[model samples]
Target chain A: DTAVSQTPKYLVTQMGNDKSIKCEQNLGHDTMYWYKQDSKKFLKIMFSYNNKELIINETVPNRFSPKSPDKAHLNLHINSLELGDSAVYFCASSLSGNQETQYFGPGTRLLVL
Target chain B: QQQVKQSPQSLIVQKGGISIINCAYENTAFDYFPWYQQFPGKGPALLIAIRPDVSEKKEGRFTISFNKSAKQFSLHIMDSQPGDSATYFCAANYLGGKLIFGQGTELSVKP
Candidate 1:
């Protein structure tokens, strides 16, 4: 079974359009995270939620928001996407905030034209 | 600033050769170190990890050598094969804190 899964594995949209990516984890973990990997393959953490409560929020723009409906689901919503927003987004989960061994899902590649 | 620094942005090794990738961190609080392997169009998967208390940990053909005093660690792949061609990342985690990853190394093992 897939431990962590993300919807819309590939997303291509025009600039200024809005879109959302859904992530689900079946590992029974309490901590979930959203990360963005740029063209240079540098991964940076965007947000983190533990038990459906937002705990960490990076310096991401307000246009990018992460919503966790429950402990098993976390979704990212992007409004007015720009060219610079084109990158790979990854969703990860761990047993707890201190559990650093995160299991990552197949990344969603988003391209803004 | 990048908390973890990795060497050799890319590497090419012959089959059966040994491939080494190094990483360094300045954060003394980081106690857990892990190496992740990633392929094209796929997410990174944890391969092996080590703690600061140990100087070395070996798993099959992969080994992690750590230097706590230097705050540096490295991953070594023995008898590298074509199937091992992928991007490898080194990450550091503070005990109860988030993980900070290195820039990653693209390793290509030629057959």
Candidate 2:
């Protein structure tokens, strides 16, 4: 069974449109995170949720928002996507905030034209 | 600084050769160091990890050598194979802090 899973493996949309990505983990972890990877393959943390509570929100734009309905689910909603928003997004989960290892999902690729 | 610096943005190795990737960190509070392997179109998976207390940790063909005083660590792949071709990332984590990853090293094993 996949430990962490994200829906909409690939998305292509026009600029100024809205999109959302859903992430779910079955590892029974309390901490979940969202990360963005740019064209240069640089990964940066975007947001973090621990036990359905927002903890870390990096220097992301207001158009990007992460919502955690529960401990097992965390979704990202992007409003008015721009050309620069095209990149790969990853979702990960760990047992706790201090867990050494994080299980990652198969990333979602978004393209804005 | 909370950064993990990785060297050799890309590397090519023979099937039986040894591949080495290095990483350095400025944060002394980072207690755990892990190496993650990522294939194309897939997420990164933890391969091996080491703590600051240990100078070296070996698992099968993969080994991690750490230098606490220098705040540097490295990953060594012995007898690398074509199947080992992938991107490798080095990350640092404190006890209660988030993990910071290196730029990443893309390894291509030639058969």
Flag clash pairs in model 2.
none
| lDDT of every model, 2 decimals | 0.93, 0.93
Query: Per-residue lDDT tens digits of candidate 1, residues B1-111?
Result: 339999889999999999999999998888799999999999999999999999999999999999999889999999999999999999998544377889999999999
In model 1 chain A, the worst 10-residue window by lDDT is: A94-103
Cα error, candidate 2, residue B17 (Å): 1.0
Among residues 3 or more apart in sequence or in different chains, the pairs in candidate 1 whose N, CA or C atoms overlap within 3 Å are none
How well does chain B match by TM-score in each candidate? 0.96, 0.97
- Model 2: lDDT of residue A88: 97
Q: Which stretches of candidate 1 lie over 4 Å from their true place?
A: B95-97
iRMSD, model 1, in Å: 1.4
